[model samples]
Target chain A: MIEFTIWDILRNLLLAARWTVVLSLVSFLGGGIVGALLLFLRIGGNRLSTAFTKYYVEFFQGTPLLMQLFLAFFGLGLFGINVPAWLAAGIALILWTAAFLTEIWRGSVESVVRGQWEASASLGMGYVQQMRYVILPQALTVAIPPTVGFSVQVVKGTALTSIIGFVELSKAGTVVTNATFQPFTVYGLVALIYFALCWPLSKSSQILERKLNVAHRNH
Target chain B: MSLIEITDVRKSFGQTEVLKGIDLDVKPGEVIAVIGKSGSGKSTLLRCINGLETIDGGSISVAGAQLLPDEAHLKALRLKVGMIFQQFNLFPHLTAGGNVILSQTVVKKTPKREAEAMARKMLERVGLAEKFDAYPDELSGGQQQRVAIARALAMQPIALLCDEVTSALDPELVAEVLAVVRELAAEGMTLLMVTHEMKFARDVCSRVVFMHQGRVHEIGRPEEVFARPKTPELRQFLGVQ
Candidate 1:
């Protein structure tokens, strides 16, 4: 029976917070690139491409993220494939982030008026050119608020990684709670760390959304 | 040979035939205005000419390039025929100059500096010299339409198709956009406009074609078409004797 000092618990969770940040960045960036490609395929004219992307999005979005972690961790091991908790969690989070990101981006892109497509075409831009030069730029303005907002979800999502035995903030909380038998104090610290990371992003996203709406309205 | 030609062109989406049988021709530098009621296929006719809307039957040739359903040829044909829309449709992310310069740099492959200079001049010509750095959302409807016109002119297409280019403008703003079209026509830019501005059609267009039910109801010099229309449909459509 060891009594864990608040300072000791805080230090351990602070160290674990680094992994949470790293995982969030890795998952967000990986998901962004893959999501962009998925969005391109979704809009491009191939029926099969669209169908495949649709299923990929729906499969990830429809399931609980915790189950995805379980499947990624245990399901792979059952199939004669061994993956560390870190790798399994990262993969599942990346897939989950990509699904939601693609949908967010697709809605933003589609929100561009049909007339914009016609205008770009009339300027002699092919499909790719139109998207790159005309449509995406406008859509990006509309896309940013939601995208920044979604990053908070990515940060919060890192908590589920601990369920797969990845030693992140939540798991550190569990460890400290077991050793110190102070669930209230340990969990409060964990919640505080999350609030610290998420609150700024949430506020910034709100500010950005307001500014964009004002700019759009003034225009 | 006509600079552009459409013979018995037909188009349909799902079960609705948008362009039943359209025939049109424009000599080099000719300005033809196609005017009709909503759903009268005025815009569809312009889109068909630029290969934006593929015709189900017949043919369209622009600047000697024949338009077909094949995507490759459609892109090629679109290059020779520029268009402007009722909505300015400028890219919201890009500045006014960026919108005009993109086609020049990417499709035309002009050097960056030259493309930028040309874009500036086009914007200036459209009375938006100071607004070149502004985004579409930052400008007024008239300004956006002017940028669109400048964007189209930057390509130097053989013909410019304007589909209700001023229809979305405040009545007061319409003249500013029409003034640019008038200026372009004066500079020998072959133009085809689908507009509801009866006065602009009578004043600026060399020929006025009245479309009814996806077919050309009448085509003649502006004076004849507007003053002494031959068909009852034309007179009724025009609401003039």
Candidate 2:
């Protein structure tokens, strides 16, 4: 059997970590755009569209991310669409992240008082104009903290993509363990790398919450 | 011709009917005060005229434009009638000037420079010219309400609806808001106020309406209503104060 040095394992995991970071960003940003669209449909749509968006959010939120990745990975093959592992993982994570982001944002929008709606509407502003000028600006400030906080969940969620054979940080740890026979050191280092990626996001969420709330302290 | 015409208007919230069939006409430049105890639906009537609340039956027409549930018509009607709330309801994120400038630019499509100029003038009219750059949270309740007035006035609406505009202010701050409303009445601006300030209403309003159990219990000149008080409900209402 060939011997593996600590540096060899570390280098491989680091290379895999890059994919984790990339997948996290892609899913987060893609989810944000999709979530915003869903928010408009839920907020501004007729009863039919509102109900459609509600169930869409609920279905994704209710399901396991691992199962979704599996469905996107193997389920598409049944329909003659053989998506690559990376594409399947990205699609699954984005859909899952969007479900959470939509609910978080909806809560932020609803927290704006009913008086704000009446006050803006009475100014001769239409619904779209009211949302653009009055509601969204205020809601956005409230949305930032939870949105950033949710990004941590998105980062951690990237680990599940490893199950789909995309070979991110967690999957790389397993591959390194099989060759090096050092499960404890490999998994511990993998956990540390995740903490490094996620800690700043968690801290920044608190910082943003404090900073944004300052504008409304007296309000 | 009357500036606002309400014919057998009705409104309900769930199983509870808030406005039992009511009718009233407000002529140009007339200042009418609607007063009653809580749950009397005085505020509901003002909200209906502004299209903030939908009427269950009958009709309301402002400046010959019917206040309909359709978005285009509601927007058209709102352009003609401005409303002030009891909560002041200034956009907390916007400055006093920004609050006043928003509708002017968005709804009226006034150029930015012209909207700013008009915002300043409206703020000056409400005695808040110095507070143009101040945010709503930074202003006192009285100042905030004045900014709300400025915001409404900048829209150049034909009539103003005040839903207990001074109710949220501290007792000492009430006079400043009333002073602004009093000035508006003096300048021939049509005003429909659901108010509790009896003396100010008597002095400034052209007519007084007493609402009870979601119906107009009595209506007449403030002097006639306060002095004669035809209904016992009105008599009892005026008696408590």
Candidate 3:
């Protein structure tokens, strides 16, 4: 067997970590935009569009992420689109993240009191104006903690992209393990890296939730 | 022509009828107080006038334009009629002046400087000139309601609707809100109010409408309505028997 030191494993894993971070950031931002569009469709009171968004969310959320990645990777091939692993992984992650974020944000928007709508409406504000000036501002505050909390899931979700041969941190671990035959050290360090990334996000989300709750209660 | 005309207006929530065959006319510079026990549909009637609730039967016209459920008509009706709620409903994220400035800038498309000037003037009229920078949660309930009144007044509506505007305040704070309404009445702002304060109704209202079981059970001058209630329902609502 070739000599593989701790430094070798660490260096390769760190390089792979960059792709994981990059994938997580891109999907999260893309998901936010798509999720907002889906939200408007669902709440815009158009029957057919609303139904489309409803099933769209259900399809992505109801199925497993691994299945989604597999479908995105190979399913596009069947259509002769022949997308690369990076594009497939990006597309799957964004769609999946958007599905979850839509429900999360819809709950936040609904949590605003009915009186806010009535009050804004009575002021001659149209639906869009009410949302822009009154409703969304209030909903945004309530949305932050849960939105941040969801990012932790998005970060971990980048791991599943490995099966598609994206060669991120988790996939790099498997390749390294095959070479060194030390699953314990290699996989153990992989989990450690993921932990290091997600722990602060989870902590910050909890902190934000508590802080916002206290601020609201103070009012 | 009257500023507002309601004829045989009816509204129902699911199977429960909240308003049944109501008819009333509000003229310019009239301050009409609508009073009754809980569930009498007084608040619902006030809401319907501003197109907040869609009427199941009959018609409501404000400023000679019929109140329709469509966005254009409702928007037009709301432009001519302003409403204040029991909860005040000031945008919590905005300052008092910001609350008053929003609709003027947005709905009326007034220039920003003009909207700010209008906001300042209205806030001062409501005795909240000093509170222009305060957020809803930072103010007392009474102060918030005054800002709501300012917000409505900034629209320059032909009439105002008060849905128990003082109901949410502490007893001490109630006087401040009623004072603003009193000033509005004194200035001849056509007003329709749903209230439980009998004294304020008798003192400040041009007419008192006693609603019972979703109909106007009694309607007349405040003195006539309060002193000589013709219906037993009104009498019992007045706690006279």
Candidate 4:
């Protein structure tokens, strides 16, 4: 029998939790950059670019993200491009996040009234100018709550990266459990760590969404 | 010379022909009100004048700038012609002052300070001087419309085209917005409006255009048109037949 103390297991799990935090950030920020470009293309871009973005979004979202990670891990090696688990996980998660986010943001942009576009045009604003001055700012307010809410899913999705051998919270739990032979204790702490990361995000998203709506209520 | 000229203008949405070969001329300082039934293309005609809707046929030229397919040319015309809507359409994200200041600074290239100064002055003109910092959603319907008017006037346009500007207001609040329009008319701003409020048109408009079946069925002095409509369409529109 192994003599692995609870303190040692907690400390190791905490170290692995750092990777989860970093992975979530890299994917979220990278997805945001890619998603914003997709948003512009989906909304106001040319016909060809618009179609291109549509297919791109559908491709990632329609498929399972775990399968995509598997391809990033094993599929790339078939072509002799050997990448690390972090690199494979990073790329897969970003693409998956971008696809979902582009659709989310496009819905927000379209929700702005037709009159806003007309009023802006009547004042001599060009397409980009209207977006910069009126449309995007208004859409951003509508987008914030759902976007923050989506972040919770993003954090949870990072757990899937561990299947491709990325040593995040879940993988760390398994390792600590194998060493300590204490499944309930080790897994309980893992769940607590994830809850600590995710709870405030979901709670604040609801609060801010309510606050924004109340602020816009008619006098 | 006319400030705005439309010759044989046509517009259609798919199978429906909204404006069929309409011609109109608006001279400087002329206050013209276009009145008609719901589907008679009055709104479409106003939209065409501002380049909000592209004309299917004929020419629209305002202030020496023609409404061609040319983007630069149309934008020039838009700058010269201010428009207000029935819905007010004030930018919700900005304060009342910011709404007025945006086009001034962005479109007209006025410096930020000067634009803010002009916005405050225009808000004062609309009798909303104290609400510079209030957002549109915070204001009442009449107040929001007034902010929209201030936004348009901030552009110092050659003429204004208002599309049922008070149609969305409550009867009580309608008076407040109409007062602002009346003051603009008194100032001799070339005003073209699409309205159902016959009394406001009669009092403020120099000439009235009664539209029916996508054409200007009648045009004359407001008194003559309202009192003695020559065409059956105008008579029916005035409800005197």
Candidate 5:
């Protein structure tokens, strides 16, 4: 066995952190676009649309994210489809993120009172026009805090992707721990990096929530 | 020709009948006040006329077009029938001028500059020209209602429906909103108001409709309904000893 230095461990984990960050961004942006579509279907579509969105939310939210990653990585192989670890992990994270996001957005849309819909309808606005002009502008105010808050979850969720050999920060930490026999030091740094990434977003979301509440109160 | 005509109209929610076979007509420049106790269907009748509430059992024609359940026709009908709500449902995200200009630009397809000018004029009419940029929550109940009236009038509708427009206002503020309505009445904008303000109804209404238990119990001039009250239900409703 060779002697190991702290610099070696730190530099390796730091390089892996880039992949974690990239994965989180890809999953978040993909999830947001898909979540928006699910939210629109949940609100404006007929009964079948509502049912489909409901089941989609339940399936992802009810299962553990680790299990979802396992399924995405291994389950597809059963069907003769060999997906790379990174693609499997990213796809699973996107699906899971979309589930929670769709539910979060649905709540925001529903919080707009029935009277706003009536007022828009009374203006001779069709359903799409009403949603575009009246309902969405109001719903966006309620949507921002949750959406920002949800980003933290997406960041934290990237840890689970490492279980499928994605070579992200957590996986890199495990490799360094096994090689250097420094579990405490390596894991501690990993925790700190995650905190550095997520803490500011958490604080900013709380601040935004308070500001929106104050704006509403003043109104 | 009558500006609005409703014949044998009916509406129900689940098993509860809210509007039971109603008939009425409004000629040009008529101001009709509909009064009844809570759950008496006065608001329902007004909503039906504007195609906001679908009628279960009859015909409503506004400005010579027969009102149907088709979305396109309803949109056409809405352009000619403005409505004000008791809650003063101005868009909270929008400034007062934004609320007023929305229908003008979106439905009427009026040019932006023209819509703003018209919104300004209507706001001036409602005594809210100074509050053109204020949000709904920033305004008092009375001011919001005035802005709501301005929002409705910006459409330049042939007829206006007010559903208890002042019921949410403070007693002190009620007169200010009613004053706006009275001014609109005097300017020959055909008006149908659902109100609990008896004195305002007695003074400004060209006709009074007394509704009770989902039906029209009486309809005539304000003096006839307030003074004579032909039906026992109307007499008891007006608290005639």
Candidate 6:
């Protein structure tokens, strides 16, 4: 049996943690783009586009992400288009994150009063101009806090990609635990790393919410 | 000449008819005040003049532009006719100056510097020159309403439609907003106002229109309408019965 040092286990897990961070960043940023597109379509697109966006959000949100990851990894192979773990996991996580973000932001966008639109229109502004100048600016302020909060969920969601055979934090923990027979230390450390990533996001969300409340009350 | 002409204009929301076979002629430089009880279609009539509400069964011509769903002519007519609302819907995200300058620079294609200068002048005209950078939420209701008037004036429209512009103000605040309307009246601006302020209407308006059950029940010079109020509805509306 090889003598495995605790330091060696931590070191290897740390290397794998880098992939976790990268995966989360990719998922979150890609999701943001897709989410904004979905929002625009849902708000202003034709009936078909609006319906498609509605179903897309519902499909992702209603299903468990683990099953979706399995389907992405396994289902693509069924069609002879073999997707590597990274591509499969990336695509799955991005879709999941986008679904939640679009719904989250729709609430924010709708929070702007109807009077804003009417007032802008009365100024001879067209629909697009009214949204750009008046509606979006107001909606964006209400959106910031929830968006940051949702990103933490994206980070945590990255952990589920391990089921697709992608080597993120959880996978690295399992591999290290199997080698050293010390599941407690390895899994515990993995949880702590997750806490480290998520804590700041939660704190920032709280701060933003408080700030918005104060700003609202001042008005 | 009539700057705004409405012939048998009608509007309804769902099953309830708000304006039924109404007619009004607004000449240039005429200060016409529409006064009535709540739900009397005063605001709807004013909104229709600006194309904010489409009439179901009649025709409207504002500055030779027929009111239709067409975008280009409607935009042209909007430039010709400015509107102020009861709620003082000044953009809260913008400064008083920004709110005034936005439509000029964006819709009217005025240069930024020119628009800013015009905004400053208009703000001064409304007694809000010092509050140019103040957000709508930061100002009192009277000041906010004044800012809304400044925003409408910056367009240099041929006529202004005010839909109960002072209704949202406190009693003390109402006088200040009405004062701005009085100034506009004195300057010979064509004004269509829907107001609950009887005294202000009598003082400033060249003509008074009394709406009832979605029809123009009585309309004449301010003194005649306020004093005689021929119909029972108008008498009751005036609390004269």
Where does candidate 5 chain A have its weakest 10-residue lDDT segment? A210-219
| Candidate models: Cα lDDT each | 0.89, 0.93, 0.93, 0.92, 0.91, 0.90
Candidate maximizing DockQ: 2
Model 6 docking tier (incorrect/acceptable/medium/high): medium
Where is model 5 more than 4 Å wrong at Cα? none
What ranges in model 6 sit over 4 Å off? A216-219
State in Å the error of residue A144, model 2. 0.5
- Stronger candidate by DockQ (1 vs 6): 1
What are the per-candidate TM-scores when only chain A is compared? 0.96, 0.97, 0.96, 0.96, 0.96, 0.96
DockQ scores for all predicted structures:
0.64, 0.83, 0.71, 0.63, 0.68, 0.60
lDDT of 3 by residue, A1-219 (tens): 589899999999999999999999999999999999999999976999889999999999899999999999999899899889999999999999999999999999999898899999999999999999999988888999999999999999999999989999999999999999999999999999999999999899999988887756532
TM-score for each of the candidates: 0.95, 0.98, 0.96, 0.97, 0.98, 0.97
Candidate 3 lDDT at B84 equals 96
- TM-score of the second chain, cand. 4: 0.98
Best by lDDT: 2
Q: Which stretches of candidate 1 lie over 4 Å from their true place?
A: none
Which ten-residue region of model 1 chain B has the weakest summed lDDT? Answer: B68-77
Clashes of each: 0, 0, 0, 0, 1, 0
Better of 1 and 2 by lDDT: 2
Clashing pairs in 5: A219-B137
Interface RMSD of 1: 2.0
lDDT (10s digit) by residue, model 3, range B35-59 = 9889999999999998888899999
Interface CA RMSD, all predictions? 2.0, 0.9, 1.7, 2.1, 1.8, 2.0
Which stretches of model 3 miss by more than 4 angstroms?
Answer: none
